[model samples]
Target: MGHMLWPFGTTWRPVRQRHRGTVDLRWLSARTWTRRWYPQGVDLGEWQGRRTLAVSWFRQKLDGTHLASRVAFVDLERSRHLDVLLAIDEDGMLQPAPIHAGGLAWFGDRLFVAATGRGIWEFDLSAIRRVRGAEARRVAGLSGRGVRASALVAVRTRVHPIDLRCSYLGRVFDADGTPLRRVLIGEYVTADSGRIAEYTIPETDEGRFEEQERFSPGLPRMQGAVRWGERHFVSQSDRMHPGALWTGRRDALERDRVPLPVGCEDLALDLDAKLLWSLGEHPWHRVVRGIPFRALGIDS
Candidate 1:
């Protein structure tokens, strides 16, 4: 059984701080509910200067039958209705890109999605019928060619085009796929026994939220990550750290580890107002809201 190396997510609940940080379920408005969305590979995208979100759904088994995997394009305000796109598949069975998908990015006029073995797939929502998938080709001497790409983030937005690629061990590269830097995700105590950084990314890539930062745990596997304004949040599915939502800010540059909701997999936010939306995995695991958790006098 070959499985992608990931974090051992926890199955726990919110802790009471001396109130384990503040949790206001009201902060999240379950505004609209539609087809149950198994959201993976989440991020903010821009099409025509407007905000749109692209997410891939996990293969679902309904009534004991398997469902094909597809990508759902959502418009934030309109109706939250989903437009599904079928990805390239050889076996016709659903094999989703990594939960933490790397190939999807808003480049030029389209969204480029990296499939498991496909090099890159471009989708032009403006011209829905013009979607294109670039065949995966091997570069001589590259041991990890055509394998699944786990993550991709274009930090600079322009010239630098700094993109991060983590196929096996996390590594950084330029826009053209030339290797630049490398990072390891294991929680290895450095030669000095101190926790070495897992993935150090350029602040700019984190959005105008250059104030925000992104990184995985030294421990293998992470539930999900979201960046808003100057804060980046991740859910650590750990029993020991049940409902753990790790955070990092830019200005004060401090890390605030807060208690999140169990079963949370995706973190979304309206960062401007200090609001957060965490999507969960279970039926009863609805979205959790974090409203200015710190200012509310909540501490873990």
Candidate 2:
């Protein structure tokens, strides 16, 4: 986030926790202090007061898709990261490969996944019964290369159920499976100290690696995401903007942008992680950032 607009210098300093001129995000060299070290996800259902991230595996996507339990699928509890070689279907017919797996959302017991670069695959989990019927159906294929390849987010507005995702084409939407409107966001985030931060990538001789070494202050990229309350929080890949969350409400979006320190977005606020965690690439790939609804004035 320090690379949003003006570079926040070398080190990030914590500031007064208030909505003043600029929000400060405590910066440093280590990656633990950022948002990546901490994994955040949404609560599909309620067990207690805390919203337990219904996640315990490699989370690389979050486009409203869920890993459904097939007739012969393993349980989520007794699973661990397969560092070694994991096996895929020899037929490659059961699991449809999407652009990302982290991007997901649960609405009315149904999980929708932006499968591949264009298709929005839907799965039924209304009762967890037989896990059958017309569940894994694919919608129409979207367009563009980078735009279709980034990630997907379903934005619910008064007018339409919009998809706020990014490929190289920026923020476009599939309204009821039809093309509607396109909007661009000057997205930004706030650090732990509420410092204003944005994103920017510069060219380097050794590409991003050498540049990253020279300038620790790199541009933040968003990963998985979901709507928290009214505002949308997002993650920016690794640890770049992990500690900070970005909010662009319906109203503030037209006037100004409000930032947050809660990275992540796969939530509607039922647990300690009231903030939302990012999964897909709304803008691009970087340290995943989180967002809160209150910061977007949705709480008001």
Candidate 3:
């Protein structure tokens, strides 16, 4: 087992409160104060209420095809990770397939994962029974493991093929309890003069995209995005500096930036705790950053 490191210099003390069987995470300010390690590769993360989910993928060449890949899910609250291998029907055998999930959305009892430039994979959480006391296995070889998808839908982004790079995907409900799929995508064309522009593409159904609303908060290099109430939050970073969390209104161009320990690859909001969460990648360890809502002038 790897030791948990408090990289930002603040000691983490137990809060004496636990949600279900998982312990609550603590932080001092808007920084990457706490760190933990998982044996899987995660490029993005999502948080809802008390649950935190991390997603990772593998891409390799198999046979003559370059589409051999799989998606891994890490249940941070339970300290467990599950690898769901992508497979296709070649003859009668289920051959390993490629499904590069870049974002994750957990709505109600459904889990939706979006592919890089392809489509979405919807999973029914109620259909998956927790497997205890067993180590994680690749889904391609498992017989009884419940990893079937409820549906796979294509995403018809309005951006051109040269500019259609999806950073993350999420779902939010309206005041009337109606659900909508919100996609955060953008393009970074050039290196020296390239500017990062983030936009929100809303779609109620699959295979279509609505009019995109571009964010003009002046923040560059958007790695992830999510919405809280009517506010839009994005994780930004540059080559010379670490990333930070920027909060602004959906209908305005102004924003407030909160500094973080490292550049974030993805962002999520824990509504129950009123905290903004971020995940960063390192060759040695995976880091998690937390910032309270009050830090960004938002009332909890």
Candidate 4:
């Protein structure tokens, strides 16, 4: 809603090809079962000199109850992972966060998770608590060595009173390809077109998002969206069939739709690695995979 506004123009098209070059994530067996927890959002960052992936997962049950959410931190080079439970500080007590963590974005030491219908919950990566002994067991039946993490605070709660289904922290480049600071928030819709908005990231510790542009992208069932330079990539899935990636420019109407892995949700772009990471949500077949930009016919 300022001078930094950019038009949100995009439309869906039929799938043209499939991105077959996907790098499967090596996940722990207990975390791969979707009946227990379904993976949603994904983002990659360097933590302690190691490339790591932070994936948000929500508890899955048949009775429409969301218990708590957890984030899986995977060491990319080592192919190992750790699950840390997400909690909220209620007065002085720690309670599980029960929102549908549909998307995530890692910026600096802060991790932003989308809370459906609410706003974004910000967590401090440096403040992840180590739970051991009785406290670990009491929290989530851990064997005295589990980890528990809590949100530092919730931000952007007063901005969008409607649904905020997905999020991504990416740069909006200028005409010469110079990167500019921006964060994009989007929604998922099955019946009609979905909307996406871009905001300037707050510099203060309050972490409020100043909306710059908003529009409906005409992409129904959108699970995630990310931007690189002038190009925007969106993932849309219906849970049963394989997902599709819609690639286009912010000022263009034509989009190249390509087939993605089944149950693909949120998207994260690793520019250094030239890979686009995503997560699959099906039970017994859940996966965290990185598809090459070449496979999507895009340069990193």
Candidate 5:
């Protein structure tokens, strides 16, 4: 495994504990002795006038089989969560989305998720279908009503053709507080320094993203990253060890060697609340917490 090198005169700061929040109990205990799903990405937005948080997860079976990915829509105010299966529409039927879903970003009515090397998958939030009974057990036509347990599924309508090259995807906003028409993608490398790049989000339906900027931040094991104006915050995990949060300009980044949760992955910022959100990926240790900007000693 590769190690991280800090800049000279780096000061390590502890993350604030008061702002941390965990997901609902139902999904929190979904990991059993045989089956498990690791939460990878998180982003919050307003849906139906309510604050909704979306968390992505990829299933892992005990036999070393990796299954389909899903996203959980958690109602923050209500303390309830709805798991939505990520799928692609095929011949009027739904097929599992076979992607890692390493990062997620909610922009306007579209939800963008990182598809690792394949690119970014775009889903229309307004097109999520609620599956019932038999339809929930099989990835077939959405129809049937018998069992009380229902499921939700979102089908991808389009894909942003930007190759991530195994990097995580996220979104950043401009100084005006408006989300820019660009996507931030970064890689996670252990032996060598990983690079972060920005791509323009196409405006039209048939348009393609054009590379806007690229830079090597020299951070290793970068699970996720987000930017606010000139400041960028990145989550770097060192497996079982405590994670670190790197913040500052791209050229001169500062590292807080302690504070972030263990196994931290993707990151998102709630600018209105002055909070930075991220999720842990380990089973039983998983949590979706938001750290206040003020607590990190950053201007809100």
Candidate 6:
């Protein structure tokens, strides 16, 4: 609602055929899936093109899913859709499930999904099999595997005062060079202030999580988040002051704001490619693209 206000951020137009244009996932179809599982009044038409809801680099293809239940793989290197995977309501649940998935991250063999009202969910790569019965059409790489719950043990976030939702998940390291897992889960309290809680995920995915630290990064409607090296990248939507993507050091509290060409709903960084992918959710214009790695200064 607030993101729709005029000129949400500094309008930086993308360079034609270079950093410009969009990968319209809407063209990739998923009608059957949405018509059955998603609740009424849901728009399976398009993603509204604003936020980058789900993204992962899996098995050499850029796997992505959005609010429209459009699950497809894009070869960003070539800017083409290699496959369109169909969504399965394996559990026969997920009413109004279309827009519930907020973020996605890869955890070894499992893909973790931050389903807004459904809590966290996981899907096993090894368990993906063909849909049992679909007379309409079929896709090869698609699966009817059920989404399972994740054991985010020990991580206590209050729903009141602040609705601590799991915004995003990322991996980073600690001071001693030891690898540390981090989950960016927090809530916004007002139009100018909110809390950002970073949690340390256990070495074992099944174990409980411990609170690493909490930050009051006075940013409104904080959405997407990802971790790179010692810095944490976050997005904030402020109708009055153009939305922005911010970077803050994990060990320190100070943050530096980077105005995006578009307001990003979710963020995922590909360090190897040196590309920062963002999902822009502006009401009139929705786009997905990668910006230069140098822009964020998270050099590999």
Candidate topping TM-score: 5
TM-scores of the candidates are: 0.44, 0.33, 0.56, 0.80, 0.84, 0.58
lDDT of 5 by residue, 174-197 (tens): 876677877788888885478888
Which candidate, 2 or 3, would have the higher TM-score against the true structure?
Answer: 3
lDDT of 2 by residue, 54-106 (tens): 32112222454432211111111221111100111224322323233233333
Candidate 3, residue 218: CA error in Å? 5.6
lDDT of each: 0.35, 0.26, 0.43, 0.65, 0.72, 0.42
Model 4 over residues 130-225: C-alpha lDDT tens digits? 554444433342334455331222212223232355433333444344445666688877854677887776666765677887767777788887
| Clashing pairs counted in every model | 15, 56, 2, 2, 0, 8
Rank candidates, TM-score, best first. Answer: 5, 4, 6, 3, 1, 2
Clashing pairs in 3: 86-97, 243-263
Q: What is the lDDT of residue 116 in candidate 3?
A: 53
Give a tens-digit lDDT track for model 3, residues 160-196: 2214544455444343334345544433222322222
Prediction 4 global C-alpha lDDT: 0.65
User: Which candidate, 2 or 5, would have the higher lDDT against the true structure?
Assistant: 5
Query: Which structure is stronger by lDDT: 2 or 4?
Result: 4
Error of 4 at 271 (Å): 0.4
Error of 3 at 123 (Å): 4.2
Q: Which ten residues in a row are the worst by lDDT in model 3? A: 31-40
Where in model 3 is the C-alpha error above 4 Å?
Answer: 1-52, 59-83, 86-100, 119-163, 173-183, 186-219, 250-257, 261-263
Weakest 10 consecutive residues, lDDT, candidate 4? 1-10
Number of clashing residue pairs, candidate 4: 2
Q: Put down candidate 1 lDDT per residue, 1-300, tens digits, no spaces.
A: 012111223122222111233433311222212233344343344544445545544444444332333444444443232434443333643222222232233433444443322222334444332222222111010123444222211111122112233211122223333333222221112122212123333333332201122333443334544433334444445433345566654223233445555544444443323344444444444434444645523331
Ten-residue region with minimum lDDT total, candidate 1: 133-142
